[model samples]
Target: MTEILLLNGEPLHTVTPQLLRATSYAHFSSLQVRDGKVDGLDLHFERLDRSTRELFGRSLEAAQIRAVLQAGLAHTDGNASFRLTVLDTDLLLRIEPPIAPSTTPVRLQPIQHQRALPHLKHTGTFDLIYFGRRAQEAGYDDAVFHTAAGEISEASIWNICFARGPEIVFPAAPILNGIRQQVLQRGLAAYETSPVLVSELASFDAAYLTNSIDPALPVAAIGEVTYAPHPESVRTIAAAYASQAAQPI
Candidate 1:
């Protein structure tokens, strides 16, 4: 679980003096590397490419990016979490032991804040972390965000999904379109995107959260509206996600 940081192909320490005051204008992706294999590696690469273009006004060479990821992963084994960051032209890859989110059901607190550029996975360290900690202190597992109009967008680090009988529904507002969500969309038979109002949490049968590392985690409650964890739907989506073959990066 030791820290392994790499810039481009060269190794760097976590406390590198230059990184201490680094600007926050960066795009990144968080993925799980198990036994040197990665799930949705292609989608992860696509995300980096899209963000690089949108944020930096240029494209990152694919072979170069792959080489950098390979270089960083050389120092790790077993399950681990990897975060690839692009700050200007510098490609930063940090690897640590895998940190899985809670498997148990979680409660979410609604926060009325929306990201400026919801599509790109840019550096949102301050507001997301602050609000997450605030929610934790207030006895919630995490915070879900909504627009001023009460349209649910996403969570601090996860995408929200709703179960309406046998179908799956996602919030139609702007979101990061997470890699895990993409994989699920490919595997699930019935899913649609619609406006999920924050004030209308009780209308759904069940809810769940998805991110890069975890497949599907059931939601227990949001604010005061409690939901009985729907294990069948969660298992179906989880199995479909697990069936996705991991590729070497």
Candidate 2:
């Protein structure tokens, strides 16, 4: 078992069978940790606050969580994945191993399944994972989900970004607004914040996915349909977030 987790500063739990099962999805947010710090921690906190209200019709107090974590966490390992969970009456925190992100851009097979509460990050996301794994299995690298409305969304784990010639677009709210999107917007790097279609994607120059974990990885190909990344733009934007993945929160 790949058991690696650091809670606060102590080794609280792991995915090991000897420990508890991973089957809960409350108002929560997962942080990308590298070395000894959390990436976009402020953003994660913001997301945790917003996601809690959006997902559970309640709000999570940052002060409370920070206090709990700072006082109880015990990190006894190296880099790991950390999750903060909050419920109506309870708050739980866990740390685990980092997820594997594709090193290169990925192709896509359109999956037109946009469910309710798409804007709110749902805990259960197997279909998304299945798409990614399937892409990798088929010798591709990623999967972009489309909808009757056109380009419904992309899964960047945190947020999805698409390139259409001179613009970097993202699906509007009701699809996914993840914290990363907010950050990108702050950087004034986001454009076309509206519903997108698969056909429109082809009309564009290129596309890629972004998140706390992966930051930015160009879209090498799109399904059986493939396109190349704009070397200059991809490099400049990617450079902005290259260090973010490992930046100290």
What TM-score, computed on C-alpha atoms, does each candidate reach? 0.93, 0.75
1-249 per-residue lDDT for model 2 (tens digits): 254343333445544542233334555666655555665667766777787777668777777666545533344244666676565445555656667666766666666666456765656677777777876777765566666666557653535666755567777635566555555655544456777766666666776777656656676666555677587567656555553453443
Mind giving the per-residue lDDT tens digits that candidate 1 earns over 114-155?
A: 887888888866888989999999999999999999999999
How well does candidate 2 score on lDDT at residue 188?
49
Where does candidate 1 stray beyond 4 Å? 14-18
Clashes of each: 0, 12
